[model samples]
Each structure stands twice: as C-alpha cells, then as structure tokens.
Target chain A: MTDEAVPSWEEVAHRYGRTIYNFAYRLTGHRDDALDLSQEVLLRVRKGLRSYQPGSFEGWLWRITRNAFIDETRRRKRRPTVPLPDDDRSPLGVAPGADEALAAMRLDDDIQAALLALPIEFREAVVLCDVVGLTYDEIAAAAGVPVGTVRSRIHRGRSMMRARLS
Target chain B: MTHPGDLLSALLDGELTPEEIGAVSEHLDMCAACRAELEATAAARTALRSLPVLDPPPGLLPGTAPVPRRRMLRPVWGWVAAGAAALALSMGLVLGTAAGPAPMNLDGFSEQHTARILVQPGVQAVRAVVEAP
Candidate 1:
C-alpha cells in the first residue's frame, strides 16, 4: 500500500491500538499475549471496518478486542502453554494525590493484581467499564449481555475488588 | 433513603434518576457506611483507570493502512472458509491432472471407440490416425 493509504490505517490503529493492547494485557496479564491480541484485533479491524456500523466506534473496536482475547484464551485452553505472569505490565495510574502517591501506587498495583483474579466474565465487565470507560449500554453491546447484566457485573466486580483491598 | 449500598453504584455512575439521586444524596448526608462504600467503589474505578496502559512494541502495524474493505468473516466461518478453499484446491488439482483436452473428431467414432480413445494408449492411436489423416 502507498504511504498515503497507510496513514488511514495508522490513524484508526493509533486511536485504539493502545486501548486494545492495554485491555488485552489486563485480561491476559502478559505483555506478549496482549501484543498478539492487539495485533489480531487491529488486523480484524482493518478488514472489518467496512462492515462496522456508524456510531459507537469505541464500542465496536473494543468488541473486536474482546473477541480476539477470548479466541486466544480458548486456543490456550486447547493446547496448554506456559502460564502468564500474575502482574500485568499496563501503566495503571491514580488521580495524582501528591502526598498519597506512593500509597496510591501500591494500591493500584494491588488492585490490578486483584482484578486479574476475578473470573473472566466479571473481569471483562469491570475492565470495560472502569478502565475503558464504556457506558452500560455500550458495554452491553460489546459483551453481548443485557445492560442490567453489565451493571450487575460491574457492581459485583467492584465489590470483589473491594474485598481484595480489604 | 434506607441504605445507599445499592443506589451508591448507580449514583457513582450518575445513572440514578433525579428522585433516586435526591434520596441517595440524603442517605449519603447521614450514612457514613454507604459514603465509605461509595468512595470505595469510586476508588476501585479510579484505580482501574489509573492502571498503567503499556506502550505496545514497535511495528505492530506492519502492513499498509487498511485500504481494502473485505467482508467481515465471523470466527465461526473461518474453518468453513478453510474447508471450502481446500475443497476447491482439491477439485482443481484432480481436474487439472486427471483429464486432457477434448478430441477434435471423437464424435465421429463409435461409442466403444470413443470410450477406448479416451484412454492414454487409445489416445495415442487416435492421435496417429488424426495426424495421418
């Protein structure tokens, strides 16, 4: 492809690539796995953009990321591979409490680890809502569940995180 | 409001109705437990958002930008696609290797001769006759 056409893809990829990569990393807890998942999702996005419906581009892009992660999860199940690390490599940050930065950083790491401990479904919902900042309806669309289900999952997911924090 | 536990989540999300919001606001005003829980959930959400977003490795996008629009094939259709391609390839190979070009004057022969002439040895004889003629 010409250099000119390359930017269009790069634009879309740049817009969502890190988001998908971080989402995948959060889900899989492995940078390499996240990279693979992000690449696959972006490749699918490249091919699937024509079929993408207008409105809710983030939701559409995230749904692709979710599917790629799920596919990788299933494949790993079929042929067991080396276990992924417990700690994720994503750059999760606090709201910048200057005096409390160190404590917040520890809490952030603890929470990130605890998040990975949740079941895949709950983890998926929480990540979509709290991390990806998707609304309930949008998450319902990406997750293929009722909005109420999304709400319930997020609530329960948060409760689980709280339990971990305590 | 009796308790802010259930309403606190929706309240944190700003999903509560105005009336529910008023009730939740009232409860948050008086109830410390619910207030703490609200802060906790909010904290969780914040921590999740703050969780570092790792920079991806270089060259993740190796190809030219998505210039072509192809049909979105569902993952379920992937094997069907591969199987279809395999079947097509198999058919092509069989047809390509097992058959030869049609004879120019095979119609003039009897059915037996036609059938015989289809075989490689008979095809040579037919070729000789055709060449001679």
Candidate 2:
C-alpha cells in the first residue's frame, strides 16, 4: 500500500523467504513441512499486509509465522500420521538410557535431529533467536510470552542442544 | 548475586538491561563456574546459529520462483471444479435410474433439465428441484 503502511508481499517474500524457510526447517526437521509452513505464512502475510500498520515488521511477520506453525502442528496432531521419533517426548527433556544414549550420540551428530529432539517451545525459541535472528523482545512479542520466558527457553534449549551435540 | 544461570544467555544475546549486564559482568569476573557456563552457552548459541540457511523450494510464492512438483499439484479451484462435475454426473445418473422405464418422457425431462440449468446450474440446485415433487 502506502510507503509507510506495509511492503508488498513480493518484497517481503524476497527479503525474508529464506529465513522463514530455514526457521520452519529447523523447527520441524523436514523440508516439506517447512515449505508448507513457509507458504502458509506468506499467504497469511499477503492477506494481512493490507491491514498492517508500520510498527515492527519483524514482530508482525514472526507472530504470523509462529501462529501458523502452531496451527499446522495442531492439524498434524489431529490427523495422526506416521509419528516422528522426537514427536512424543514431553516438553521437559528426558535422559536417554544407555542403549538409547548410543543411538542419540550417533543421531545427534545431525544438527537437525538434535534440534528436532528439543521440546517444541524450546525449539521454537532457539530457532527464532538463532535462525530468524529475532531479539528477545521480538521473540516474546511473536510468541505471546514474557521476555523472561523467551530468555529462559533460549538458554535451556541451547544447553540441551550442546549436551546432545557434544 | 546468585549463579545468574539464565542471565548468561541473556548477556550473550545482548538482551540484558544495562544494570543486569553490569551485575552479571561483575558476577562473571569472580565466578569461574559462571564464566565456563557462559562459554558453554555461547558455544550452544554459536552451534545453533551455525545451521545452514535453507532456501524455500521454488514456487513458494506464485510467479516468484520456478514451480516444483509438490507445488504443481492442481490448484484449489481446479479440484473444486472437478468435484462439482463428478457430483453433477452422479446426480444425473441417479435421477435417470430413479425415473425407471415407464414410457420415457424425453420431452418433459429436457424441459425440466433446461429449467434446472437456468435456475441454478449447481449440483445442489439440481438436488433441490429433483427432490421437489
């Protein structure tokens, strides 16, 4: 629309498309899911651009991306497709057994696997911070959480990743 | 102060308030455990950020990139149209069979069909009129 109101969808896509794709990929560890999620987010951004005001574009885009991701996750949950290895673990990290630990050591070498192994909330925070390069405040706004929560999640998530990757 | 456990990440992220940063800095100077924790946290941050940036497959946005097979699946409107056509065909067959062979009134059928088309060409319209006496 206007110079100040919102950038056109094409411009947004060109500028942020790769980042969004990578964000989804890191979160889900699947390229197809990433593509679907990216397209869905862009579709939403296109539809929402008209009503957008000129505040924080990063915050706005990421908020849409986060919500779309959650919706997609819920949709998948309802349909119950082939379950991924890391899908069923609780939000808190559970220690792997000796046999599972060896398997994890091998699997954790793949960064995406390690990332997928983190709980969703922690994974989202890490991806948003490191992949999307969002500030803590921006992540908090996008996630609809307090900044402290964002901070805690990122720290804990990265710690878990380090433990796995080590 | 305390361990400043999570504050280590906030500090590395440059997110700590000025006062928090100063306090954490002072704490780190005296605390080897916290310094090591900060380094571990920084390493984790580095590893996470080291992930390769992946480009969205072509055609993530229409007309912006080359179309990929996954995206080349029929558009939504195409599927809708095909579904509508199948429904109309099935309803037509049902109606024809239900009419039976009692001296086929081709003329009456044509007139009614034309009327249905004129009123509403959709399958739902056909069902509404067909279900009517």
Candidate 3:
C-alpha cells in the first residue's frame, strides 16, 4: 500500500456523490440515466479504488464517469430504439418525458437544452471546466487530453453557446 | 489596449497568469469583441452552475445498498457449471460399468470361471490346457 490514506467507499460516496450525480445528470440530461451513470461511477470507484494510486481522486473519478458515459452512448447507438441525437437524451429518447413528473430540481430547462445542443466533445470540456469545476490542467488530465486541447474545447464550446445564448 | 480575443475565455476562468491577466484586462478595456465574448462565456457558466444538483436515487451511493439484484446466472458460469455436471455424470457411469462385473472377471480360462457362466445355460463343455504343449 502507498503512504497515502485510503478513503472508504462510503466516504468517497458521501463526499462526491452529489457532484457525480450532477455531472451525469448534466451530461445525460435524463434523471434515470443520471442515476445509472452515477451508480456505475460509484461501483467502478469501489472496485477500482484498490488500484487507485491515492492521487488525483477527482481526475480518476471523472475519468471513470466519462468512460462509463461513452460506453453507454456506444451501447445505445448499437440498437437505438428512438432517434436521439447526441443531445443528452435518454436511451428511450423524449418518450420518457411524457411519463416523468416535473422534477423538483432547480435546473433551468432552457440552459440544459442549450447545453445539449453542443457537440459532445466540446460539451464535456465546458462542463468539466464550468459545471464540474475542474481547473484547466485537471480537466485535461481527467479527459486524457492535452492542456491545449482542453483550452480549445472550452473556448469553442463557450463561444458556440455564447452566440446562441445571446 | 490590444485584442484579448480568445484569451478572454482563459481570463474569465482565471486560467491566465498575472501578466496574462494584466494584458487581457488592458485589452478588454477597449476591445468590444473580447468584452462581448467574455460576457457570454460568463453567462453560460453562470447558467450551467445554476442547473440544480440532484441527489442520486436511494442505494445508488455506497452506504445505501440497493436490495434487489438480478440473481441470474452468468452465461459463462452457466456453461462451466453445466459442463462440470456433465463430466461428473459421464465419469460416474464409466466407473459404475467398470465396477459392476469386476468380481466376475476371468483370471484365466478356468473351470470355476466356466461353471459360473454355465449355471443358467445348457450344459456347456469347456476345458483348460493343464499341460503345456
């Protein structure tokens, strides 16, 4: 074992649970999918914590979250039951909206819709920087991309939304 | 003041160094383009932050374990378990056959061996060569 302390899964969950859930919800735009994604991230964290080097917990956790989202996206793509653009829609797409009650979340539907309009790559970068609140280098590290790429994505993502938001 | 251009973004996120911030700040004083972009990014960031953070449904976290899990057998394990059972049954049958007539096996073409088999049959004549030719 490394000299660094090992945080129990309970502790990690208690600490980052809301953050991870929010990240997934913001990324997927569907509460059920968000739940699934957060649970997946937590499960992965529990299992992979032994291998975690006790550094950059945020980076590691976010990486797992991103990867899980990618896998889910690919799985959905293989057998899409509905026409869902890469717009953070659920696997069943907009149909679930009919059954779902208006949630008590303070999320602005307009902003969430605007965010979903962005391309996935740029959206991930912007969300990591602004919503997920990672520093540029941390976002880059978590995304497994160069700092320069992170910079570019943030710039483009914000610019696109900026044009549309105004 | 020069054009901060895209550096407005880096400055908005506080990613800029002291010197870079100074430069961008000076540029933003006169550059309407940079100012507009900066305002937009800030607005988008604010809007995103305003999006609510919802608590995950119960048991999705660590301490609250979900009660119901699909206890179905995994396909690979199912195949392995089935294969093991089949192997065990086949081995049992083979061993059972081998052990069934083990006591009745003939050590040689002896009179005793022949009498044992002819007990339920018509009188069968059999003789063993007592003298070697």
Candidate 4:
C-alpha cells in the first residue's frame, strides 16, 4: 500500500496494542514494564507503518513487538538493577475466584517462573509458542532464525518447563 | 515400542502424523508407562491452556493517545548532509591553500657533477648543493 493509504496510528494501535502488550508481559513477567514496552512497540509501529508491506498484520506486529522487547531488555541490563516484586493482582483488581480459575492462575505463575528460569533464547521460544500461540514458522520469522532452530528451542524449552512443572 | 512420552507431547499439541498416531495408540494399549505419560502431558497441556487471558495494564491500550511519529530520520539525514558539505568545503580550502607554490628548481644541479663532487671528500661545493641550493 502507498504511504497515504497506510492506516492511522490509532487504527494500528487499536488492532495490535493488546497482542503486543500480552507478548511483552509474557516475556518480562512485569505489568508496568510490559505497558511501557507495548507503548514503545506501538510507537515504532506507527513510525514504520509507511514502509510495512501489505501482508500478515499479526506477523508484522509480532516482529516489531519482539524487537522492542529485546531492545528494552538490553537497555535494562545497562541500568542499575532494581528487583521487581511479584504482584499477581489483575489490573481490574477483580479476581475470578473460581476454583478452576485460581488453579489456572497458579499454574500460569508456575509456568511463568519456569519459563523465566530458562535461557533467554529458550524462554522466548516457549513464550512465543505456548503463550502467544504462534506457529513455529512465525516464531522463526519474528526471531530472524531458521525454522529448525525455532523448533529445537521450543522443544528444549518445553522439556525444561515440563521438568520444572512436574 | 516407541516411548509414549516422545509422542505424547506431539499428540497433545496436535502435531502427530497419522502414522505416528496409530503407532502411539498401539503402544498406549500395551504399555501402561506410555499411557500414564500421555495422561500427564495431556493434563499439563490442559492446565496451560486454561490460564487466563490478561488485559494489558491500564493506559497500555492504543486509544490512550496516538504517539507522535518522531521524525528522527530527517534530522539524522540533515546532519549527514551538512557534514558532507562541511567536509567538501574543508577539502576545498585545504586544496586551495596547498595550491600556493611549486618548489623552485635549481637550474645547474645536474646528475653529472654529483659523483665527482662526492668523490672530492670535504668539498664545500657538495655541502652548498645539499643545502637546498
């Protein structure tokens, strides 16, 4: 599409903001950081929309979000380390309170912890595959790696998570 | 028999080939170990799938405010062009200054007199020629 025909920033944000935020949150496990990263990703998307090809919007958004997260991680590494507390409350502050819901949240927390315990490469693969539900090919594209590498990372990551969960 | 754990995850993920599924089924029937592994992997996958979909924290939604497209590249390109212009100007000035004068050639300093002058040791004529004559 031509530059003038590109969608507005608001439209792009409305369509992809939530997905990018969730992907960031799954990677960082911190809500505040996720929010900031999501905004940053959206900002980049807005700036880059003119050049974006007419294709899979989800894949394009995913690629932007992944790069934004990686950049944030690098920036964070250079700053003084401040420990982030584990705050499990939902933003709405309304707990589902169902037995199944609570159990699922608990499992989610466990899985998140297990995922964090992995190397960054493995963690990224697991989050993209299991949490974000991207296909292996999509993950490969987002990560700029080969499909075989993505598959191996996902397989190794899942094995590690299974071991930890069990 | 193929280890059930090997196939169990693929089955749970719906990645099993038809042939692999048939083999896994046959193995599951005879091997209690394989069956248990499949059951555990299935349970874990279900638990994982049940996790709640969380809304992003407040103010993270795209509608809050449109991020102004920061025209970063324009300024960067401007600076690069300015630098190139400055470099070209500086090179022009340097060449202009360096174009001032060619060194004056000594008219009589031919190679034929050099060996005789050098062989006459302590000759003041050689010293005068050597001193930028």
Largest lDDT belongs to which candidate? 2
Return the clash pairs for model 3, or none.
none
Model 2: per-residue Cα lDDT over A1-166, one tens digit each: 2335578898898888888887887887766778889989999999999888898888889999999999998998899778445452222234666576555444434667778899999999999998888889889999999999999999999889878877
TM-scores of the candidates are 0.63, 0.67, 0.65, 0.63
Better of 1 and 2 by DockQ: 2
What are the per-residue Cα lDDT tens digits for candidate 4 across B1-133?
A: 6575545666666656799889888988898877776666565455555555678655666445445654323345645664685697778753434667544334322322453455567667668779964
Candidate 4 retains true contacts at a fraction of 0.33
In the range A1-166, model 3's lDDT, one tens digit per residue, is 1337678788888888888888888788777778888888888989998787877667777888888888888888897856334443332234435644234121366677778789988888888888789999988888889887888888888778767766
Which residue ranges in model 2 land beyond 4 Å of their true spot?
A: A1-3, A83-109, B62-133
Model 2, position B121: C-alpha lDDT score: 56
RMSD, every candidate, angstroms: 21.2, 15.2, 21.0, 23.8
**TM-score of chain A, model 1?**
0.80
Better of 2 and 3 by TM-score: 2
lDDT of each: 0.72, 0.79, 0.73, 0.70
lDDT of 4 by residue, A38-80 (tens): 8899889878887876777666777888888888889888985
Candidate 3 C-alpha error for residue A45, in Å: 1.1
Clashes found in each candidate (C-alpha, N, C closer than 3 A): 9, 0, 0, 0
Give the TM-score (vs. native) of candidate 4.
0.63
Superposed model 3: Cα runs more than 4 Å off: A1-3, A83-107, B1-3, B65-133
Interface RMSD of 3: 4.3
